[model samples]
Target: MATWAQFAAAEPELAVYGRELLREEQGYAFLATVSPGGAPRVHPVVPFVADGTLLVSIAVNSPKTRDLRAEPRYMLHATVGDNDTEFAVRGCAREIFDDTGTKWLRAHRELNVIDIPLETVLFALEIDRVDAAIWDDGPPHRQTWRAPNG
Candidate 1:
């Protein structure tokens, strides 16, 4: 798996577009995890980058949190407007507890009215693969990247 910075370094343009799609003004993404029944459970999320790490926080006892702890595999889809442009990331989200993680979590709590940033569980989604499609007058352009070991 690769870190966000590494992905950017490998695919500068694709990474830039991915970041733009993820951090839009209405910043949102859909996090897909496996439910206890082995089905996909997707929920909207506010995903952010910290020191090249992709971190997302959820309510401590939320089903998604439990799902992640139990099975880290996930597919995170960035919100694309009417263009039908597809941008997505697939990876294993591992629980994190480091200074970088804490700093972001704290800042998040200070910036938002919600308590989840301060009290929720956080995980870093290491990039296993990235996919994007771009449209420019003609047929859409597709791009993809896989971690060196992924």
Candidate 2:
């Protein structure tokens, strides 16, 4: 798995486009996690890149948090645009309990103009692979990038 910075360094163009798609809808992205019952659960999450990592803050008591704790593997997909542009990353989430987590919560609260409770937790989405496509006429332009150790 790789940090966002590493991915950007490895695939500059695709990384920029993917970042745009991820932040297009107010940093909205769909995060897919594995439920304890082995079913897939999707949640709308706000993702932000901080300290070279792609991070998302979750409420400590949220089912999403529970799922990540039990099963770190996850997929995060950018919200598709009107033109059907798509971007997604598959990876494992690593829980953060350091100052980075605190900084993320504070920044997130400020950005959204709301209060984020202290019980919130942050997770870094370590990328295994990235996939994207852009559709215009005929077949869509597609690209994929995998981490060196992924």
Candidate 3:
């Protein structure tokens, strides 16, 4: 298992998908999870990468959210560029609707208009592992790491 710090250092290309990139490519994220019957379900969603965890606020009535709650294990696939320079990670998720989660959701009004229950658990992903690809040799770089709760 690679530590988050090691992943960050090895996958320098991920820097291009930081928060600023979220504003433009946020909608391209694919949230994939397994259904109760062992079927596959994948949907396009906006994701926020904060505190080393990824967040996607779903409506209380969303089928995906329901499926996710039942099965916290999921994979998020995000890509940029024609060469398919993508990043994918599988992690457990839990819903978040608490005041704090709601506040975070509200701060980003552009995300959605759902009232977002205040009891939602923050589907926090510890990022056990990640797979990333870089198609070009533009330059060697590193992404700015956001301190947790900073």
Candidate closest to the true structure, highest lDDT: 2
**Candidate 3, clashing residue pairs?**
94-123, 95-121, 96-120, 96-121, 97-118, 97-119, 97-120, 98-118
In model 3, the runs with Cα more than 4 Å from the true position are: 1-23, 110-122, 137-150
Candidate 2 segments exceeding 4 Å error: 24-27, 113-115
TM-score of every model versus the real structure = 0.91, 0.93, 0.67
On TM-score, the stronger of 1 and 2 is 2
Best by TM-score: 2
Scored by Cα lDDT, where does model 3 land?
0.58
Error of 1 at 113 (Å): 7.7
Question: Candidate 1, residues 1-150: lDDT per residue as tens digits?
Answer: 999999999999888788888873645799999998899999998888877888899888899999998899999998884577878999999898777777888876676554554777789999999989888788999888999989
Candidate 1 TM-score to native? 0.91
RMSD to the native, candidate 3? 6.2
What digit string (tens of lDDT, one per residue) describes model 3 on residues 36-55? 99899998767765434457
CA lDDT, every model vs. true structure:
0.86, 0.89, 0.58
Q: Tell me the spans in candidate 1 whose CA falls farther than 4 Å from its real position.
A: 110-116
Please rank every candidate by TM-score, starting with the best: 2, 1, 3
RMSD of each: 1.8, 1.5, 6.2
